[model samples]
Target: MSIAQIIGSRHVLAVQNLHASINYYIDQLGFSLVWQIEGWALVQRDSISIMLGECQDDISAHETNNHSYFAYIEVTDIDSLHQEFTHNNVEFVSQLATKDWGQREFAIKTIDGHRIMFGQELLF
Candidate 1:
């Protein structure tokens, strides 16, 4: 089997404020917390999973160095999600717009400067 046939995938993020970040995802955005550990937490929605790794002691040094990459999640409604982020004072970089790839998406910046793009497939 090829790598594309992998059964599961996990997207990890190195967070400076684990509790606050978890709250933003679980409480504000409505993602369910699937698992939690001393310095890690996993939030899930359908096939998407967001893993939070605490960076207090640099146990996950490799992940911390990869903060420049962005995670794009597929959602049913982009506008509603964007509104929730705006209402909660989340630092989003842009409004929902159609991309060259024919997908409607918006970007939100986390506290540690990671850009998460929420995307929806374009019908037209």
Candidate 2:
């Protein structure tokens, strides 16, 4: 009832370059291509899907660099994830660090410069 009360969550990014975006998402981050259309594709990690679509024709409509949004994903092990990222040569914005919020985390920027923060809960 009432629109199913939000079944799941998803994030979408608009890109001028689709192939490169897909490559970075799939080849680097281990996301799988769930679906693709003429100018759009959906990449999934676990049950979460990120929709990457072609940018609109209007240049003004495109989001500017240094002003993009980032995604924060909760992972089980920060050390393991950091190792994988290092092995893959993924450019991490920062090395793993503990936050005041009781999360151990690191940040990375995708090829398109969208940031991703991988975090784990801090143990006592």
Q: Tell me, what's the RMSD of every candidate?
A: 3.9, 2.7
Tell me the tens digit of each residue's lDDT in model 1 across 40-83.
99998788888988886654433444555467788888888788
Task: Note the residue pairs that clash in candidate 1.
Answer: none
Q: How many backbone clashes does candidate 2 have?
A: 0
lDDT of each: 0.78, 0.82
Q: Which runs of model 1 end up more than 4 angstroms from their true locations?
A: 1-4, 57-67
Question: Which pairs in model 2 have colliding backbones?
Answer: none
Q: Pick the TM-score winner.
A: 2
Model 2 off-target regions past 4 Å?
Answer: 1-3, 56-66
Tens digit of per-residue lDDT, candidate 2, span 1-124 = 4565777888988777888889888888889999889999999988768999887563421245555545789998789989988888898888999989999999887777777888999877
Please give each candidate's TM-score. 0.77, 0.85
